[model samples]
Target: MRIVILCGGESSERDVSLASGGAVARALLERGHEVVLVDPAAETPVLAGPLHFGDVVDEFAVGKEPPSGLGRRLLQERMEGALTAGPVLGLLRDADLVFLALHGGWGEDGRLQERLREEGIRFTGADSTACTAAWHKGRGQAALGAAGLPVAERAQWQPGIEGVPQAVRLLLAAGPVVTKPVADGSSVSVHRVDSLAELERVAAETGSGGVELLVEPYLPGREFTVAVVGDRALPVVEIELSSPLFDYTAKYQTEGVSEVCPARIPADFASRLQELALRAHEALGFGAHAYSRTDFRCDAAGEPMCLEVNALPGLTATSLLPLAASGAGWTYGELIERIVDLAMS
Candidate 1:
């Protein structure tokens, strides 16, 4: 099979996406599949054929933060060429399937998925509609909670709304709160604030004219994530952070965080989390997806509280999904092959 690994959009997760794409491309190649790598934001596919995965991975192996200016520049280029497929999509059209290793905004929010659908190209992960719903924290939370899944109380905010600040202040007054971009991943801009002043500051710093915010009560407990592939949960992985919040630095920079696969929890508790994860995936219309990862934080009583679902979970070497997959006895190459098989089926 000829696979085009589409990755590295203008979103905040560009660096992680590049790593994921390189990893996935290599895995698929190891499984004897032809793989082509491309960054849609650049509008050109890597035509030199599959490079050594280690070489490509080395390029983005560093833990530095993805620059905001780079995101803006790539976003500008994306918007300018939004409707133009150029060569990247052209290459995708000829491939058996395109593995979506991209994450965050344009990649995971359904825009690129819609473009692929319009071009009649098959890709891994969820469809456009499901991706759209999953990317919106508030909407996805509401849907999952309505389906009888446990979700923390959450409020959405737009920067300039008339009563938004007051409402946000009210939410903050209660106790510690978590502030994050309403439609982002990789824990970008995710912060836990204990006071109204901190919340105000976070709002001011993260608040942009275009980006909305999702504020929720900060649930202080252990963090665990479940990866679901074709209706089956692989395993639960616990994320322990030395810092107060598991932000982008801890995730990509390999600092102050440790992940334990097959989380050290009671069997029943892990089973319940896996079940809840599947429920969240189904409720959000991602049942047919190649795979999705659901994040959770245990409350005081140890009950799992759903955070949000990742329609296209990160597949980088250090990403939780691959860790869980390994715990479930699947090698990286085997996991990639399973994902491709699921998508093609």
Candidate 2:
């Protein structure tokens, strides 16, 4: 399979995208695929860098990393051309398949997928509309609830003259609220605000970003993320954080977190979690090409309260997908190969 992975995006998750691309590229190659890993930072005659679905740029600069001088310069040049603008659909004209590892913005939110569909490009995951639905945390949650899945209570911050009142209503409905940007991933801007004063302070400080916020009831339980690939739930990856709550630092750079697979939770409860994850994926209209990770909080009684699903889970070597793959008896390379096979078939 001649696969080109679209990596690096205009989202805050740009760095994470690069890491995932690196792992995906390596795995593809190890399994003997002719893989060309292209970061938006490395596209020539094409716009590469960060494209907030084409608005913002996260800047995946190639020459910025530690590498040989020639390699650095060549990469820098290729990365420079990726941003040229006709469309990703146009740029991908020559490829057999695109393994999308991008997070946030147009890429994850189904914008790129929509464009690709217009060009008849074969890719992974759900259709453009489905991705868009999955990407919006608030909307997706509502959809899941309507599908009759068990979920935690949460509220969204819709902007307008009634912004404050709406927020207050959301809080009043579910609290102490866990607030963060609605469209953001990896828990950016996420904080557990126990007091009204703290919530007001955060809203004031973080408001300039302009993205709407979501406030959900802070559930008390063990944090577990159920990984769903294809139609089946792979395995439960239990997230153990050094901090009381899992924050950004705990997600990436810091070794402050660990994941336990098969979760040590009861078999019946584990099955339920997997069922909910799959149901959420299906209700979102995801197909065989689509993969998502559904997170949950299991109370002491082991009843799972569904958190939102990450339709675009991280693809990096250490990400939950690969971690779950490891636990499910698929080696990193094997899992990557399987995904590529699925992406086109």
Candidate 3:
């Protein structure tokens, strides 16, 4: 199969996406598949051969802070015809399956998926509707809550939106609240606020930038993630963060975080987590063969609460989806092939 791996869009997660794309391209190549790497945001859409994880890893290492000015750059690129450039569309139409290694921005937020569907191109991961449903944290949480799945109390605030801050303040009254972009991944711009002053500052920053914010009661318990491939939920992976929050640095860098696969928890508890993950996936309208990763953190009562569902989770060597797959007895190459098979089917 000739697979085109799309990555490195004009998002804050561009570097992370490049790392994921390099890893996926290598794995697919090792399996004897014809792989073409494309960075839709690049001046030259088609990437050269000999993709290496180390190349991207060293060049675009995720730092302690998320990349800034990407939101504006994304808007600028779109206006300049980034994803819809003739070269990118031509490559997509020629592929048997387009593996989306994209993380945030238009790539994972349903815009790119919608374009692919309109062009009649097959791609891995969820379709446009499911991607849109899952990309927005508030929307996905609502769907999960409607499915009777446990979710942390959350509120959304946009510029000039009245009454949202009041609701967030109520949540803050209970405990510290976390503020993050309403529609983003890789924990970009995620901040933990302990007081009204800090919340106001963060809210003001987002408001000035015209970005919507989602506020939720901060859960400080054990962090775990479950990846669902096809119809089954893979083993849970526990994330031990050295920092207070699992920010971009803790996620991509090797220092501040450690992941324990098949998390050392009671069988029943792990089973419940997996069940909730699958339910969340289905509630968001994901296809039977589509894959997604659901993140959870234990609340004050020690019960896991759904955070968000990732329609196109990262595929880097350090990514939780591949780690969970390893716990389920699947090699990285096998996992990549399985996703390809599912997409082709």
Clashing residue pairs, backbone N/CA/C < 3 A, model 3: none
Worst 10 residues of 1 by lDDT: 51-60
lDDT string, candidate 3, 1-345, tens digits? 778888887888888888888888888877777778888887776775434333331334555565678465754474248556576788789888899998887777898889889889999988999999999999989989999999988988885566456788799999899999998899887899999888878788765567888999999899999999999999999999988898888898878899999999999999999999999999999988799999999987798999999999999888899999999999999999989988988
lDDT of 1 by residue, 1-345 (tens): 888887777878878888888788778766777778777676454623654334333345625675475346756486337336555656778888988888887788898789888888898888988899999999999999899999988888877554456667777888888999998888988988888667667777887666789999888889999999998998899999899788888887666698999889999989999999888889888855558999999777777899999999888888888899999999988888889988899
Clashes of 1: 0
Worst 10 residues of 3 by lDDT: 50-59
Q: Taking the tens digit of each residue's C-alpha lDDT, what string does model 2 give over 131-218?
A: 8887888888899989998776677664432346664656655556677778877766678787777877777755444668777777
Model with the higher lDDT, candidate 2 or 3: 3
The parts of candidate 2 lying over 4 Å away from their true place are 41-91, 158-163, 166-175, 299-302
Q: Model 1: which residue pairs collide?
A: none
Worst 10 residues of 2 by lDDT: 49-58
TM-score of 3: 0.93
Q: What is the lDDT of residue 201 in candidate 3?
A: 82
